[model samples]
Target: MISTAIHCGACGARMEPGANYCSNCATGRDDPNTRALFVVDGTTGLFNDAFTGALVDHETSRAMRYKRPISVLVAMLDHSEFIANDHGPAQSADLLRELAEVLAGAVRDIDTVGYLGDRFCMVLPETDQAGAMVAADKVMHAVAAHQYAAGHGQWERITLSLGLATVNPDRMGRQDLIQSATLALMDGRSDGSNKVHLVSQMS
Candidate 1:
């Protein structure tokens, strides 16, 4: 597949029935093979950017309509450049794949985890700011507890930083939520990696 976007009408993230994509994705909308390739990141088996964005937007709209809390978290593997430099770009990608599994395991089943191009994003439904922090801690601890095989049977522990944003119906939209999470991620990274930041903490 050439990696072109194919969004579905039902949810905007295109997929076919029984495909290895998100639950709402496989709405029997697009060709199975094409949908799978378009929606999934081949390396990590997570939703690709186009599909993830749709999921985010969908969740945001739902949260807004129902007056329920929803949180979005943006995370990045700390010192990824160092990992790439020390090992190779492939190794860095492998580490990311491993991290993706950890993230999948750490969050609730209802939560959606995806690769948003350069970073991993988690969309948490019914999760407010406090719940988001708890989820982030689970992810951080889960990652810290696991070790990745760097090379030559060498096990290396990896870490990450997370930024969180909860939808504020009064003032926040999808873009605002994403930007807040990105800013929070930046704040945590600036203070030194392995931290979780919130937009409210921004000085």
Candidate 2:
């Protein structure tokens, strides 16, 4: 008899003989849903947090070495918690996934998009503050115009609260850049949702 035992290609976990899937990692040879081991979010198919951080660090180092400008944008879905409570978690996840696609399509080829916790972040390479603002505006309009699944055979409009921070590699770390964008996002949220806030010049 052909043995069903195998190792998970994604996670390297052993699978029992006759088992259809790897018990440890849930990967199967024939499973169509199996994704790459890391670097991808299971839900949205965007880069995961760890991989995102690594990319940010690498980009920051390159920017510092070359003295180029870079910008990061942190965007949060407005009323996302309420959407989850009202429409259910599954629908909320669906909305997030769709939004991820929209974000991916809205950015330039050199830009990177990833999910960072409850928010989504974009890294704009070789972009200064003005260029980042233009990109942010494009994303804002795209998100606001897209229709999201609202459950029960209805669609709803979605808005994002976005924060932008630009760096010229003037002694700023990746974490500091992220934190600056996050602080701007918080300020936007405080003012009300569906708005973009730029990091203060003094920051």
Candidate 3:
């Protein structure tokens, strides 16, 4: 689907990926709302936490209004601490940016993906538990397929331990759903890496 994430200031045209100016009118985007709509990595550009949270809030409301399912996925790199300690924070942070890019490419433009605290989170609107699992699996596969610089010019593979939670809007709020997925991810990581764990509404 075409993403209506941001629009041109001059002509109200939709901004395309990797665009700094409007393709139709070449208008410069200085609008705060435009920045909020574009998701970027922390080190690279503007990463808006409030925007992600607000998107979740809107999605939750939409799900409730439509009686649909919404799923949240929380994922972290396996041995992340070790990577930071061994290779330094810069490398680890770079990997995270790469992870975010991979995740951005893996899902639809409508989906929200960004750093929620230290871990990465994806909010999938109208996605049920099954769809969330599939997305999580795709992420794991994407991580496996991409190689990262391990420092000293050596490249290595990394894995993700992901947690997925799905619920109808009537069951939980945005934060609650994210927390459920995060807790599930913690549990799954304890068992093994490169795995996707699923959870439903709390209690």
Overall lDDT per candidate, in order of appearance:
0.76, 0.78, 0.70
lDDT of 1 by residue, 61-170 (tens): 87778877888899988877766778777777787788889899999967878898789988898888888899999999999888776432333787888989887556
Q: Best TM-score goes to which candidate?
A: 1
Model 1, position 191, has a per-residue lDDT of 85
Runs in model 3 deviating more than 4 A are 1-41, 44-46, 150-155, 169-175, 200-203
Candidate 1 error regions (>4 Å): 1-35, 150-155, 168-175, 201-203
Question: Model 3: how far is 161 from its true place, Å?
Answer: 0.6
Clashing pairs in 2: none
Error in Å for residue 27 of model 2: 18
The residue pairs that clash in candidate 3, if any, are none
Candidate numbers, best lDDT first, in rank order? 2, 1, 3
Q: What are the RMSDs of all candidates, in order?
A: 7.1, 9.6, 6.4
Mind sharing the TM-score for model 1? Answer: 0.79
Q: Candidate 3 residues 76-120, lDDT tens each?
A: 888877777777877766767766777778877557676765788
Q: Tell me each candidate's TM-score.
A: 0.79, 0.77, 0.75
